[model samples]
Target chain A: MSEATEQNGKHFPEKQLWGREGFRDDPYIEAESLEVAGDAPAVILPLAAWLGLDDDVRRTSNRRIGVFVAPGESIDPLLDKLDTVPLIALQFPAFNDGRSYSKAEILKGRHGFKGELRAVGDVLVDQVVFMLRAGFDTLEVTNPVALKRLSASDLRDTPGYYQPGRGSAKTAGGFSWRRTPAA
Target chain B: MYRYDEFDHAFVAARVEQFKDQVERRLSGELTEDQFKPLRLMNGVYLQLHAYMLRVAVPYGTLSGRQMRKLGHIARTYDRGYGHFTTRQNIQYNWPALADIPKILDELAEVEMHAMQTSGNCIRNVTADHFSGVAADEVADPRPFAEILRQWSSLHPEFSYLPRKFKIAVTGAEHDRAAIQTHDIGLHLKKNEAGELGFAVYVGGGQGRTPMVAKKIRDFLPAEDLLSYTTAIVRVYNLHGRRDNKYKARIKILVHETGVEELTRQIEAEWQALKESDLKLPQGDIDAIMTYFRPPVLPERPEGWGALAAAKKADAGFAAWVDQNVTPHKNPDYGVVTISLKPIGGIPGDASAEQMELVADIAEKYSQDEIRVSHEQNLVLPHVALADLHAVYELLLADGLATANAGLITDIIACPGLDYCALANARSIPVAQRISERFGAAERQAEIGELKIKISGCINACGHHHVGHIGILGVEKKGEELYQITLGGSADEITTVGEITGRGFSSEEVVDAIEKIVDTYLGLRTSKEENFLAAYRRVGAAPFKEALYGPVSRAA
Candidate 1:
């Protein structure tokens, strides 16, 4: 892997995901002053006290956290998070996956999220163009594969297809028909 | 039949323009491949084994002849001159290029259609009974609610990025024709004693690796709270669904891990919070949507409808086709004709360009210009005149679409398996064909009686195998195809997850095992008329298991 992942210690390999539930009582994870995106349970401050975040406000910092983009994932949550982060990396569970692509596009084009939009996981050389089109300026190519040697130009290839679908279907098969002005 | 309102029209236009800009940006190398993948998928586009598959939602399986013709135009002009109707009641054009999708979407939009959310983890195309409006057993048409769900879910700000793909299906009949129990969220419409409409909501049902029948979260929910209650369920799932492991990300997993009772409590809490919000469905809004879906002006009972007896006597082929394809209509003079998209020896859900045009013409002529795609890999002309059944039958016969096997063993439901699907472990079509050929005999299918055979290439259960009376799941073992057979699952109100009896079957022996099970049911059934599902339920899987694993020698 690149210098980014010199060793798997004290850090996630590519991205750190903070779902509703996360690693608790783990030495690697700090238990204090964590900020949740869009959703939080009742009594977070109290939980902080319960977990002893009361003594340490700095524990939540330095623990790099990120947002998620899934198939039919709402774009607004990620958009709201973009305003505060310098780099927002998207994870594609599978290579042929499409949901995260929409998130990247909305983040860049619509929400104006130009700060490092990274593509992580199942990131293949061939799919580089799709990743580029979806507005992921940075790519965390899995395992520092052969594609790591690609120049900036190579990763930024033109993605074919002209349809507008990002942030469109909020759900699966949740499509709408668009009428174009006749030529 | 639900026409697009201005809001819907405006939303699609904005989305189209947005995609156009994205495509332009991609072509200019302004973005990288990593950035563009999800954008394409949200547009109902996918890069598959052969070509880019563009899946267009046929909302609730309802389509007008005009829309069908528009689909045909796109197929003939942009694609390989045909589209495959998916099990979710959506039509997929398998050969569209990535470059042409926007233009295609534009064309679709002109016809009040778009390919949004045809893929991805979002709430997918809401599916309903193909015979929704015209079914004799229906108390209410599920299309309006499906449309409402479509609107509420479309580009919904809070739910675009979910843990995984979410699917919902609706059925309004006492007889569950829409396979509602097998969806991530399923709803059944029933009337209360006070003549008020309500829904019976089922949650957490899914057909992936862990095939499950959704538990009833609420037996009867008031109609006004449908949207709000559903929003509560999805929100609860979004907040609590597991994201650490992809396999366990589905709401089914959440419901399973949390226990349905507590999940129900959480949903109740969420609903209680949103009980009085704008999310609460208003009577006027429901009426407005429902108004667009009322029955067509049908003719009075015709003499030829009763004269069908004479016609059957005169034409045996017509009789067979009628017996298989025609369903009793609420209007006694009419019938809903299920056009079998599962033509024998053909792909289970595909339609040729010619078939589309022909169906379009047939729809305009005899079926009130209405067409529906059933989740079971078939099409329905929801308003066919009973007197014109012969005419429809003749045209269908010429096109090789006259398969008289709806709900019979030969009418197998199959997913696009290893041949095209990237996720499939083995091929599912050939198995479906083998079974179809084995049960192709009219006499054999007639003897077997009302068997639902659903096959999935993998555990995703895209074929709804879990709820099938006989579910065949294809998996790879030692680099060879091994089929696992599960028996006695029902997708109806009494939904039961099928149980695997024993060892997996080879591709060659899979159909034979199905054969053995059917034979046992036939032998043990009290009446020749007792269908496979009824017999399996009455006698349980012991008899079928014995028939499949080979009879345990009685030690005589």
Candidate 2:
């Protein structure tokens, strides 16, 4: 378990949140109580808690809101409410459990969600490339070794791909054969 | 054989470097064994009972003489002097140090060969009909499509982490030699009424603890939509397949529980969205890949027929080898040569480095540098001219590769069970050896014509025991090894799972039990023309069961 650390007068887990640009401060805190809507600047809640909020409260809340979806949870309930949330975190209970990958594809490709898609748990360096391909823009990495590798920018990957993904299409439309200079 | 272009070479080389780093991290204790298991498996490295076993992919079972030579070099340098050819058309080295694997892969890469995706939950090596181009009945070669799949599924980010391992097989012939019905996705290449090439797609077929024949979802899908349609099927399975139970995780279980009609509807719906997407293959690209598999420009050998006739009349042993191990090729002057790896009383698929190099040399000299490894654990020279048959036979005879038992009783398919694999309850090779010894007589084997004996070490069915005409399953029962016999299964056009007979036989009694079954078949068949499968199908398993268990067990 990650220890809670204080920064900028806000307390959150010592999880390194990163995006394509670089490491950034994690603003959203986990909602302690869904019964009382707190006045925090930003709050992240479980799927059920997010779904339990009143429509008027959801519309009127000044705080930035996000929902974390568990492994087997369906994203159907959040489809119509995509515009109200700026971040949607998909949890990988274990690195091998890949149900969230389908969810990520559905959220980005089928539902056309423009929000920041984040991978929350068990995020490792080996899987980060796949996470990026599956439409995750942000990652909450807690593994110490993965963090060290990420900080050193030592990600290992091939120069070419045989299939297309949620990432930018590098090659002009033909057959999705994209290759970069060897890393 | 498809030569590796610059892109393909770069891809494989980068993967080699990536794995080398992963291995280094594992040795340095930066990555624990638990974290390193799947990574190593993706690169075809497995921690076996005795040592690390590396399985290298022989794409669609086709190889060049140079590639075969490279495999021999690897076996001699990094591993023991021998390598085992698996039913998936891949070769496995039973003993290779973990540190030596990177070097082995580097050697493989030099010859445009690799072990990528040979194991693991991701898509495994795509297999096809071993006699793809040379088979007389084939409409077109299936290797091109298999190559397409091999590239697309190489490191597919979305489908790499699947619920369970997936296998796909393809066949272009009317007679199904690739065992398409026993794969996760089986593609039958054919031409429709409009004379357009397409595929009849079958999904969710597998053999394991629970064996099920694949169900056809689409009668015909255009060739251009191959990748799109495949992506659709895999996506649906990856999202909705059962993950709670590892045994029930295969797509076959999903098709069973979800019902064929419903699963087909889901796959079709998913395909509808992706049919016109960027995944749709371009015709030019398909043509480009197809060019790699075009039939070799064979020289006319009109003199071969006269020369072969004279040679056959002179040598009886060469005549027997020709009769048993050769098949009709599309070219009139050529014959397809099956180099049997299963010598009498020897291990089923084990080939020594010397044998491999010898095969390479023969292929280079007589077979247009083309070699294929059959899924039934045999090597094939797909384009040997009839004129050169005697010379090839002499070369093979000197090395003990001239086994005149292609479809005979001695050509038993056995897995490296308790001897090498960590997941075995009983030994398969020794049982195979004993059975081979019992039926080593050529005349006796010829009497039991076209009998397929497949043995599996455990319930995982890697040896494909379920589809054998006489399937033998080895299991551990009450601290002793027991063998179960199944009857009447076939993997041809009309595929059927074998039926288990009553009771089991101890290791000592198993060979005798098989003898009784064979004896019963010989006694009951109307004529020698009736093969074991045809006879068993016509009369049912009653006679064999009676022969195995006697009259009293029937009443029980």
TM-score of each model, in listed order:
0.78, 0.96
- RMSD (CA, Å), each prediction: 9.3, 3.2
Q: Candidate 1 lDDT, tens digit per residue, A11-127?
A: 444433211122112112222234532232211121212233322332244433333333344555344445445455565656644557645654675568755666655665545
The C-alpha local distance difference test score for the whole of candidate 2 amounts to 0.88
**Cα error, candidate 2, residue B152 (Å):** 0.7
Q: Any idea what lDDT model 1 has?
A: 0.74
In candidate 2, stretches whose alpha carbon ends up further than 4 angstroms from where it belongs are: A1-13, A32-37, A54-56, A168-183
What TM value does the first chain of each candidate achieve? 0.47, 0.83
- Clashing pairs for model 2 are none
Go through the candidates in order and give each one's C-alpha lDDT.
0.74, 0.88
TM-score quality measure for candidate 2: 0.96
